[model samples]
Target: MKVNELFKEELKVINMGLRSFADDVKSQDVPVLHVDWRPVAGGNKKLSSLLSKLKSK
Candidate 1:
């Protein structure tokens, strides 16, 4: 479909990591799914690697 089709569709948002943005969208009566998300291992490389290894088990 054309890019303009996106504008014609209903606006729904999956807002991750920012409640304020979801709130703003909800204020405009748009559907929003807010997710409380953060970077893996708090942006630490070592811990992220460790977690990734564990997930492979």
Candidate 2:
């Protein structure tokens, strides 16, 4: 094959890859909300015991 043909094929592959990546980025560009909890000072023994019991079961 000629070098020009090979180069064109590589460019096509790269263009396709870039388009796919751009589509993915655009799809995930929305803001997201997350929830989390923090333990109180010294922690709650009742909550800790419940968690341990749930894990064992």
Candidate 3:
């Protein structure tokens, strides 16, 4: 298995947090999976604590 063989498949990217970067990659015709990301609980300590407790169930 040569390194060149690995590149035979089409390039793909998973863009997190920034949509503009993903859009730029798409401009080059490459496929991109965009994930909208934000700070957990919007930077609220209380809300984040509550959410974490809920997930423990």
Candidate 4:
């Protein structure tokens, strides 16, 4: 239950939603897995539908 014990194994992290946070973690030499996140339809339903249709082609 100590920090050292917890890190006895390689530490891995999945960074969600924030690229700057992940970059900071990487700067400290830790491995970071970044997932690209965005708001659904970017808050625009019409644009979302248009993008979806374009991608289906």
Could you give the C-alpha RMSD of every candidate to the true structure, in order shown? 3.2, 15.5, 4.2, 7.1
TM-score computed on alpha carbons, candidate 3: 0.54
What is the C-alpha lDDT profile of model 3 across 1-57, one tens digit per residue? 766975998888999977999999999999999987787899899999999999998
Top model by TM-score, which number? 1
- Model 1, residue 2: distance off in Å is 4.8
Pick by lDDT: which candidate is best?
A: 1
For candidate 2, write residues 1-57 as lDDT tens digits: 688786665332112223555455446753322323346334788878888788899
lDDT of 2 at 53: 87
Local accuracy of candidate 4 as per-residue lDDT tens digits, 2-49: 888877977878999879999999999999999987765877989888
By lDDT, rank the candidates, best first: 1, 3, 4, 2
lDDT for each residue of candidate 1 in 1-57, tens digit (9 for 90 to 100): 676997999988999876999999999999999997888999999999999999999
> Best to worst by TM-score, what's the order?
1, 3, 4, 2
Per-model TM against the reference = 0.65, 0.27, 0.54, 0.52
Question: lDDT of candidate 4?
Answer: 0.87
Show where candidate 2 strays beyond 4 Å. 1-42
User: lDDT (0-100) at residue 49 of candidate 4?
Assistant: 85
- Name the runs in model 3 displaced over 4 angstroms: 1-6, 45-57
TM-score winner, 1 or 4: 1
Q: Candidate 3: which pairs clash?
A: none
Weakest 10 consecutive residues, lDDT, candidate 2? Answer: 10-19
